[model samples]
Target: MTLGTSTSPLHYYDVSSVDGFNLQVSMVPVGGGVGCGVTGCETDLNICSPSTFE
Candidate 1:
């Protein structure tokens, strides 16, 4: 998603696999301000065993 003016603005974004989980995804904001940092799923959910959900 986008925030602020188009000329000079801030941006917020992340990778999502809501419908389905394929490859691992992550997001790291460089030189970010407060509350801005890395976010994502580093795990390989595709190969996870059913027991893992328990």
Candidate 2:
């Protein structure tokens, strides 16, 4: 399984407020169990702080 999270550009600078947006994600599954021949897959995910922008 894979996982990830989206980031906002407004986070770079100190802004008063902003509108609304969605954190969209897309993935394409491979055929069969053909992978890197490893036991399992390695995840490269980004963990974002929930209360950072709030």
Question: What RMSD, rounded to one decimal, does every model reach?
Answer: 5.8, 14.9
Cα lDDT, all candidates? 0.69, 0.32
As a TM-score, model 2 comes out at 0.18
Top-lDDT structure, candidate number: 1
Q: Which whole-number lDDT from 0 to 100 does residue 4 have in model 1?
A: 57
Error of 1 at 42 (Å): 3.6
The digit string of per-residue lDDT tens for model 2 on 1-54 reads: 532337532211121223322233333444534432223213322234255554
Question: Please, what are the lDDT tens digits per residue for candidate 1 over residues 1-54?
Answer: 456587877677756666557566777777778888778887877677365442
The 10-residue segment with the lowest total lDDT in model 1? 45-54
Clash pairs for candidate 2: none
CA lDDT of 54 in candidate 2?
Answer: 44
lDDT of 2: 0.32
